[model samples]
Target: MRVVLTTWGSRGDVEPLAGLAVALRGLGAETVVCAPGDDDFVELLARAGVAHMPLGPTVRSVVAGPKPPGAAAAFKLAPELVAARFETLARAAEDGCDAILATGLMPAGARDVADKLGVRYVLACFHLLGLPSQFSAPGRRPGTPSPEGETDNRKLWQQDAERVNALYGPALNEHRAAIGLPPVDNVRDYVFTGSPWLAADPVLLPSEGMTDLDVVQTGAWILPDDRPLPDGLEAFLDAGAPPVYVGFGSMAAYAPKDIAGVAIEAARKHGRRVVLASGWAGLSAIDDGGDCFVVGEVNQQALFRRVAAVVHHGGAGTTTTSARAGVAQVVVPQIADQPSWAARTAELGIGVAHEGSTPTVDSLSAALATALDPQMRARAEAVATTIRPDGAAVAARMLLDGASAAA
Candidate 1:
């Protein structure tokens, strides 16, 4: 069987699909990934031994570019990108594919491609909040009004749908028209099928209040990481008690103005060493101290196991990785589904959610102190033991089984 897994946005968006692609390959299925042409994504897919077909420029170029465009400017380019995405995925699956699975925004194009080829299109989501749930709120935008009661939440969701429609609906319909497909009335409903697969660790995140949405929770799509830590990092880990691991994976727009001093000071207050990841923000150690270590992208699955606690931007991938490693966490959420992840972490008693994105030395120290507590660490370890590691395999089997049944 052959599969094409397409994704966009940050590394977090690409990693899960890459894991699924690897799992498909392991089951003797040819898999190709359509992702952004970012070098980081290229390196990640290469390491996983998956075939990568670039769709367009990486999110880095658009978000962190020297002349980053405003919302209106970026929206102006959406139609072309939507059209390009449809063209790219169609080509990737031209050789005949069993399934085309897509995640991230603008999946309607992928759906159209699948319709054109008479193949099944599988829509997968990493965050549970993306789906409609009376229990939880929708993925919050940067400055939207918070919903109050159940009625308010429902209205908020409807409002959110309107926002999505106004933003991407026109472009989506334009592409559909170009391909002789009928325009969709509800963009959100069109992208989110009647049933969508939820790729998240069930132990850490479970679907609730799923009214009309029949979500298939296939656990988190996590790739097994065997890459050894860099020599310098390994030496640092060997030299001291596991440091408090701090890194906001790939939140380019989540610019926490002074994360360096805040995180380092907070960790130091707890008498813990620090391992700082210089993500897109270019965070670095402020002082020349041997107790601190600075690093670029490394293996979180391996590194989290050695850390005393994990502090991050509460991305789905990072949250799951830290939970699986059985380490306590402190999540400083900036936007989107991050606040939800942070809330879940705190609810599970395995971590503390920093009040807001910008953390002061004292605020982060308090959060770290809570996470460093022995009881919380114990709960994290217990939860880790229950986290299933076969989400990719389960999803792969489901795809192949569907193809077999159809045949």
Candidate 2:
């Protein structure tokens, strides 16, 4: 069977799909990794030995550039944002895959192709972005919206239903009409994984407004076991009591040098060593930095094991990694779901969430000190032990089962 998986976003988004592809491959499925429009990520996939098909340059332009002015008001202005993705997915669907899977970002395109081919497709989500049931995690009230202002659970549920209807509803009908297949009545025709409603086994997840059935918690898609650690990472491990790992993936520091200086000072204040991830985002070193090392990408899994504390922008991938690593953290959330993850971390006793706006040296120093506390460290590790590896094999089996059931 052939499984075509589609997704979009940054490395965090693309890399997990890669894990899914590898998992599907192990299940004896010929996998085709199709992402909306990210030529930039093509090399990374190639390096990982994954087959890929890029959608279109226009999709790339839209995702990479700033959101079109007033996109919220005029969806037409951002055709590529919601509408033009079908053209890209359709172009890819001509190959005639057996099953298509889509991430939350590009469901329309996946739905269009699945309807055309009369094949089954599934929607996989890494997190409960705005789903109704997602609000039940902890500080949630029924019928109330997320306190974060991005969405209210009540409004988001209605909006999600409407968004799917207005965006994917018509495209799917047109594709079905051309292919002589009847249109679906509701958006639920597309199967969903990682939501609680359809999960075979109960997992700890929010339980408020979630309504979709046919859901399965495929576990968190994470890096495979074979990804080798970066060279010389061992030296850093030996340098001191596992240093605090700090670096915001993809988000460039406004002033790496200044940030580095501040970070070094903070680490010194807390009497800890620091390993700064020197990624595309410029992160500099401190002027007084004696032993602080600014290095490039290291195997996150391997590196996380060697760290006592993790300080990062609360990305989903990073949050899972830190939790699984059993390390305390000082979360300095930048935007979007980062704050949510940060807040969750603090509430769960993984560590203290940095308060206020931008992460300053003084605040970071204090957070780091708290994270290093013995009780906090023990709690974080205990939580990590419970964070069962969302087994890749299980998710792989589910994908294969979906295809086999369709047959």
Candidate 3:
């Protein structure tokens, strides 16, 4: 069997697809990943021994660039993203693969590509937001209309579909016309299809908001990381009681500008050292203190094991990693889906969900105080024992079995 897995957005978005590709390979199938052409993603795919096909421009430029009017950039990029994926997925599967599995809001091209190739097309999501639900209001994609103060789920979804149509319909039809496919009327349903795969830990993040769809809840697809911590980082870990960890991952720019120094001070207040990740936010030491160490692209799977508590922007990958490591967490949510992760952590009794992204020393210190509690740490460890690590293998088997039956 052969497969093409495609995804866009931050590292969190692409990593799951990479994991699935690796799983497929382990099962004796050919797999390739079509992802953003960033150097980070390229290196990641290389490490996984998967072929890569670049889609669209570097994501760093978009996130790092100055904010456009609210959703302006997201709106502008939607059509372009579909068109690029339309061409790239086709080229990636030119040799004729069995399926195209994609993650992210923009997968019209992948769907159409699979349709044209007469292969399976699967839409997978990392979170529970986009799928329609009467149980909860849907999250608005960037540049989509927000039903401010809206309570009705049906009305909110109607507006959501309209935005998907308005933002992507014309460009999608244009690409479809060129590909000799009929123009779709409801682009939203055309992409979401009937059964979308939810690649989240079912225990941690339940398959919620699925009134119209039969959502398949696969566990979180985590890229296997076995790299040892760098020598300096290991030395720091050994030198002190496991320090509080602080990093916002991709949301650094949007997070409070002073979060780094504040988080350091907050950890210090609890008489703990700190291991800071210089992620996209480019965090650094607040002072020349020996208690703080700043690192770059280190091994999270390894580092999380020794950390006393985690402070983060509540990214799905970081949140899941912390959960898997059995470490207490304090999630300071910055944007969409983050607040939900924060709530999950708090609800699980494993950590404190700091109300918002902007954390002051007092706020973070208070949150850390709760997260570092012995009881909370025990809960974290208990939860960690149940986080399934077979999501990729599960997804791979499903894809191959479905394709074989169809054939």
Candidate 4:
């Protein structure tokens, strides 16, 4: 079966789907991945041995860098509102395939292709795009959804629904008519994300309104095997025992120097070494006046395991990676989903938040102490082991099974 996976956004967004594509390839399914134009993602797909097609420029411009005040906000709502129009959609669909799976905001075009081909479509819900409870890690009992999960945050979801309608509804009908296929009952029906026949768990997912019968918790979908650690990382791990692992993933957009002094001071206070990642956002230079080494883009899963504790601006992927490594986390959220994941880490008792709104040497040192505590570290290790066996191959098989049914 031919399977096409479409996604847009930063490395965190595109990389998961790429992992899925690699898994699908293992099943002998023909797989193609589509994402906005970016050399990093392009190279990543190639390295993973997955076929890729570039859609457009990487849209990080909206989130970071100097731009129009609300440009990011507008694009966040309806990405199609700012991206290549229906022609791109048409072109993507032109490649015959059994099914099309796409992430949020970029689904309109893929949905058009799915309708044109009369094939099944699935939406990958990496985060709570419209779901409120899915917005934050709930404080409820395990496996229970939060009360506010359903309560619309001032009709934000309805706006998302409306935005979906405004962006995709017209093109959907036109595409259906062009192919002589009946229009779907409602645009939402084709939109399946959670469970029994047509659903699955959300990431940092709330448990409310879901039953054991509704969704399968396959744990977090991650790279099947841990990548090799860099040359200097092992030495860092051995330095003064496991020091706290501090690095924001791809979304960090601050001047590294501004953050460097604080991190070094904190590391000294805790009497631990520091391993900083200079990811796409350039965070390593924050090492001014410190002995910290800015390790540029190393294997996080492997590195996290070798660390005594972690401090980060919680992206979902980073959060899960740290959790799976069983090391306590000290979250200094930057923006978007960072705060929500930070709240979850604190709630789970595996970590603590920075004392102040912004992380500083004092607060970061305190959080590190809490994270490195024996009890917290043990708890984190247990959670990590529980979720570590997440089956990328199984998920790939599931996608292929869906495609085979479609065929």
Candidate 5:
């Protein structure tokens, strides 16, 4: 079977899909990763030996570029961006492909393209974003009870659906009309069609009340394996005790240097060694001194295994990696699905979630103190034992099975 797996966003988004592509190829399925034309992602597809086709703007460009002032402003602008990018997605999916499996970031036009092509369309995601749930909502404060009741939750979901329609409906309808496809009133329903695959561990995040959506809780789809670490990093690890890993994945947009300095100071205050990743924000630009090693991008799986604990921006992929590594986590969420994952982390007793979106030295120090606690370490290790190791393989089988059934 020939499958086109489409995804966009940062390494956190692309890595999981790349892992899936590798797994699909291993199972004798011909897979192509339809993503942004970024060098890193293109090289990743090449190394994995999966076919690649360019689709959207590179995540690096977006992360490195200027962002809107507030979350509301960013949210308001998201639909226009999605609409603008739909043509590329349509072109990628309209080709001769057996099926199209798209991440949540893929515009709703992907579903229309798959329908026009008369092929299967599947929605896959790492976070619980598109799936409707009364018990939880994306960006909700962690550990807070559902005060508004199911009616209120449903209303909120409907409001979200309406917002999506209001934002993207015009441009989406224009594209639909051009393609001779009928316009959709509910964008969420159109985008989240088919048996959606949730690439998160059921052990870590169960699917108790999510029966309403045709969602599959495939365990966290981690990258296949680790790449070799740099010689300097290897020496740094050997020179001292396991240092705490501090890096904010792709969310270094605002003030990376200040954040890095804070992390370094906090680690110093605790008398702990630290390995700080530069990530997209260029955190490694900060000078390295005693007990601190600043480096460029490295294999997260390998680094997490050797770290005493992880302090990060709480992306879904990072959270899962820390959990699988059996290391305590100190989540300092910046935006989006981060707060939700942070809440889940604290609720599971695997780590501590800082109270706010932004982190200060004091807050990070406190969270790190909790993370380094003996009890927290033990709980994290226990959680690690429950994460399924064959998540990518399982997801691969599911996609292949769906294709075969459709055939």
Candidate 6:
């Protein structure tokens, strides 16, 4: 069997699919990963030994250089951008593919491609955003209370649905019409097709009233192993007590230096050592010395284990990494589903979610203090105990089972 797995966005998006591809290959399925044509991403696929199919714009171009303030402004071009991405998936799926598994960021036309090719399609979500729940909104900010009434929750869900349709409906319908499919009225419903695979642990996000959707909680699909830490980072970790990790992943591209400085200052105020992840945000430019190490991208799993606490943008991948490593977290969410993950981290009692989009020194210091508390550390360790280590294997088996059943 040949499986084509597609995803978009930063390392968070690409890493999970790469892990799944490796697992599927082990299960006797020839796997291909279709993602942006970025050199780093292509190199990642090459290193993972998974077949690669380049598609869409490079993530750096999309995320690195930008002139947007809020998440809403950043996504102004979503319709056209998503349409172009779907066209790429459509073209890629035209090949002899047996199944199409896509991440949450994949365009709605991914399902259309599977239908057009007569193959099994599975939608995999790293977070709980895609699954509709009356208990709470999908991507609400951390610490925001769930609506008391189910009616209010449904209304919030409907508004999100409308917002998605408004952003991608025209282009989506155009592609559908071009491909001889009926127009979709609800983009959310269209995107959440087939047996929905949730790439998170059920213990972390229990499915209580999500019976309307065929949701499968497959745990967290972590990368196979850690890349070697830089010599400087190793030396820093060896020099003193575990340092706090501070990085915003792809969220703080515009002001990485400023963000890094703020984080370093906050940690210094609390007399804590810090490791700053440059990631796509370009934090490597900051040249802070003495107890503060500004380094380029390294494996989250490895670094989180060496760190006493993690202060980050609350990406789903980073959240899971911190949890599984038994480190406390301080989430400073900026955009998209980050706020939701931040909320979840706080709700799990493993972290503190700093309020506001940008973190002030005071707020960050306070959150960092909370994350380093003994009780929070214990809770984080307890949460780590419940996470399945073989999420990739379980996801591969689930996909195979779904394909067999469809056949």
The C-alpha RMSD of each candidate to the native structure, in angstroms, is: 2.4, 5.2, 1.5, 5.7, 3.8, 4.0
Between candidates 1 and 3, name the one with more favorable lDDT. Answer: 3
lDDT of 1 by residue, 1-407 (tens): 88889987788899998899888888899999999988999999999999999986677877775343566645655655677678899899888987788897556578878877777778899877667766656764322344554456677778777766766678888888888888988877777888899898877777754545988889889988898999999999999788999898776666587898889999999889999999887889999988899999899999999999999999999999999999999999987789889999999999999997899999999988889989999999998999999999999999888877765
Q: Compared to the true structure, candidate 1 yields what TM-score?
A: 0.94
- Candidate 3 stretches with Cα past 4 Å from truth are 142-150, 208-211
Q: For model 5, what is the alpha-carbon lDDT of residue 47?
A: 73
Query: How high is the lDDT of residue 26 in model 4?
Result: 75
| lDDT values, one for every candidate | 0.84, 0.64, 0.87, 0.63, 0.77, 0.78
Better of 1 and 2 by lDDT: 1
For residue 366, give model 4's deviation from the true position in Å: 1.8
Q: What stretches of model 1 exceed 4 Å from their correct place?
A: 65-70, 140-151
Q: What is the lDDT of residue 171 in candidate 1?
A: 84
lDDT (Cα) of model 4: 0.63
Better of 1 and 2 by TM-score: 1
- What are the TM-scores, per candidate, against the unseen true structure? 0.94, 0.79, 0.97, 0.80, 0.90, 0.88
Question: How many Å off is the CA of 404 in candidate 1?
Answer: 2.4
Clashes in candidate 3: how many?
0
lDDT of 3 by residue, 1-407 (tens): 88999988889998888889889998999988888998888998898888999998778877865452257776778888988989899898988799889887567678998988899888998887777888887775655567568788889888888888888899999999998999998888889888999899988898755457988988889889999889998899999799999988876457666888999999999999999888877888978999999998878998999999999888899999999999999999887788999999999998899976688899889999899999999999999999999999999999999878766
Where's the lowest-lDDT run of ten residues in candidate 6?
A: 138-147
Q: Please name the candidate that would achieve the greatest TM-score relative to the true structure.
A: 3
| Model 1 pairs in collision | 200-220
Q: What stretches of model 2 exceed 4 Å from their correct place?
A: 36-40, 56-78, 81-85, 104-106, 133-156, 159-214, 225-228, 252-261, 286-288
Clashes of each: 1, 10, 0, 11, 0, 1
TM-score for model 5?
0.90
lDDT score, candidate 6: 0.78
lDDT of 6 by residue, 120-151 (tens): 98888887665677766655422223456645
Q: How do the residues 1-407 of candidate 5 rate in per-residue lDDT, one tens digit apiece?
A: 88888877777788888889888888988887777777877877777777777765566665676652444544544554565446655565554678888884636667777777788888888877557777655333222234455456677667667766765677777877887889889876788874677888887677656635878878877666658989989998999888988888777565334788888878877888999887777776346476888877577788888888998888888999899999999888777778778889999999888898667788789888999988999999999998898889999898889888987
Tell me the RMSD of model 3 versus the true structure: 1.5
C-alpha positional error of residue 286 in candidate 3 after TM-score superposition, expressed in Å: 1.3
